[model samples]
Target: MELSFLSSPQIFFTVFTLAVSVFLYIFIYHQTNRRKTNYPPGNFGWPIIGETYEFLYGNSEKFIGDRMKKYSPKVFKTKVYGEPTAVLCGVAGHKFITANEEKLFRVWRPHSLQKLFRAPFLPNASASIPRETMVNVTRAPGFIKTEALIGYLGKMDTMIQQHFNLHWEGKQKVQAYELMHRMTATLSSRFFLGFEENDPRIEKFARLSDGMTVGLHSFPINIPGTVFYRAKKAADAMRMEVQQLIMEKRAAMSSGIQTQDILSHMILSSNPAAGRFKSEKEIATLSSALVVSGFTTPATALAIIMKYLAERPDIYDKIRAEQMEISSSKKLGELLNWEDIQKMKYTWHTSLEVMRIIPPFQGGFREALRDFTYEGYTIPKGWKVYWSVTTTNKNPECFPEPEKLSPTRFETPPPYTFVPFGGGLRVCPGKEYSRLVMLIFLHNLVKKFKWEVLAPNENMIGTVIPMPGKGFPILLQPLST
Candidate 1:
């Protein structure tokens, strides 16, 4: 009787059923216990892949906004790029994470990014300089701060003039995006690497920049045909080029051929006795990051500002008038200076409005150093957190009639509400640098020409930064002298 029962198909089915029931009971119990720990309320999507596809492929603002609507406005849980991530929204979220820098939270970049940037020990490592500190040092007084910034104006002016002569002047139509990209690239090279616009290596840097931007937010796949793989390759090439440049610059410095740009500064600081010293490799890594970050945002912002100006002739007239007033104060052939940049108040305000209307970067990431609670929700350790300027900047509570491009709204607003360059301890060090460059570009642009947007209603493609749909073509109308 026992042998016959064992051989029966029904008995086998019964055994399988029992096993499944036990498994389900154990799983449900574990999940129930985990839920009791009170992690933040929201969906984590599928295992591994998570909502990363939706976040990357779709509109960043809408994606986060919809989530905020569905879940808690302060924070929500979603996994992206194979990591469990919590997105922190609004003013409170921005303050909480930014204020807790290096305490309960630290900057986090994915493995793919760490590899691409060639920062072997990032996030937190004893041997490495913290990213913020590194950036702040690189942006100190003689680097990108006021003294160094003032010096860059003439060089930037020369580059812009060259850009207009080469790409804009005498041309019926020029792609604003392409021209801005080149101009920004040239400016970055001059300021960061001490390279002239005509230097052959400038083209190489620019091309590699394109590859790096494409890969910044892509999937971490490193397969031959993948965007990440291509980006890594480009980074590798750029890294090598930078290393050579550092060596050359070091040699030049040793021979008393001093250079005033960032690379030269880093070389001088490489002394072990100097608390702010960085090794050649470290210097190169920072320089590569600088090139990518330095140009992309300002270039994108400049293009968008130009587009908005073209659409609003009244606004354009005001900016042009202000710029002409500044130009009139300067002698012919004289370049802009620090004082001139400060005087373009209206032009700068207009730029702020454009940034608020369409931020160049949608958001940024931070990682939890320890488990923390936010608005009564427990955020576990080893989790990634995000803060979006877009979320807060567009909130009607923060900005009345948030969609409007009224610069006057900036006359008075809630503190930490409009953070185009981010805020708190982690605020972008290049804020002033970008501001100076933008004002210079605008002053030169409006002084020399008036342009009409050829594609006013074109769609915008959002990546790590927003880009014009049609490369933002414009018909140049040079202003009469």
Candidate 2:
């Protein structure tokens, strides 16, 4: 054979070794350079991987709480998402983190979320518009308005009855999470894109929503066979579907067949006179966000509430009584109105208590805008920060016996103590919309049937939202007339 320069095993081995050596040198150098004086005390763990596996695979709260006990209660440091992070815990920490939005810290999504969502209109450091401006556009009279919400109630009631008839009417057993997920997806689809519940596209959108949620906390790797890779694919599919829907809806709008769904609202609001105009891409992204947020959160919340109620019959009885009272007030074959929702005070209180115990959105991330000190420790500029709802919600100081289910706590919740929907300028705009979804669903669910969770002590577990492990299988029976 002809001698080939540098083709010897020895030469190949030398090059491989040099590459490995250089990688290690660069990794270690970056780790060393990232440290700062008086940074929150906690191990950075192994290079690259850091404490992500431990943080995600196990109880994230305990991981952060254990560090809080070891290092500091208010703030602790570790590496997650391949970056050094300082976790802020407790009511004080929540207040500090949320109250100082944009000024001290800006909204930060993991690379996976950025790639998955890719909504340029959303609040982020790179967004052209201010976060508050986005909020105003969403809250504008033309979008999710009071009149529009009132119109949604009758349709929701109809959808709920139809969903029950199709899915739960004759079934002796069903998975609460699975069923609720489907129902919410249907409702969200109807609202967002005017898609029918059984439209095949709703199921496709639901699958993509599930993928996004499951892959949210996963490592942001693009390699084939990875969770984030699948999620990105799902996102791409969802975007394509939404873009096509936007075209159809825009055509429908131009034809004078005005629809009152979210897409239509977005189109109408884009008029220059409305003082807000989002590009079709931004509208699609935002609409998909509505579908995602509308589907998963209320679904998780409804399932958890049902689980708790099944385990606590007395609470269930009270809720049933309240709902039964509401049903009695309505005329025969009448649908729910906005006033019907206002009267569900006690039931809403119970839902709030359940949320306190297990928030669907466990917490969120923020990135430091500049070097900032918290309780004597310096969080260096560009360091990621996490404000934990689990930590703050379960603080004994905030809730007398944090584990105890007490709806009375909401009678006069302490300021900044109970933040299921977050706090300050970054408060969720869909808060009322979520409440309506839950309350309406609860009303319909209770009036129709009583269920018992068949899974023994089925606990919640997932990075997306803590959902019951067995999907919370339950035995269903119609309530006696």
Maximum-lDDT candidate? 1
TM-score (C-alpha) between model 2 and the true structure: 0.89
* lDDT per model vs. reference: 0.81, 0.80
In terms of lDDT, the poorest run of 10 residues in model 1 is 120-129
Q: Which lDDT tens digits does candidate 1 get at residues 288-364?
A: 88888889899999999998888889999998898888888889898888788888888988898888888888887
Model 2 worst lDDT run, 10 consecutive residues:
125-134
lDDT score at residue 213, model 2, on the 0-100 scale = 77
Candidate 2, clashing residue pairs?
A: none
lDDT of 1 at 95: 77
TM-score of each: 0.89, 0.89
lDDT tens readout by residue for model 2, 49-142: 7888887778866776788889888788888878889998888888897779989998877767767766565455233333454466567654
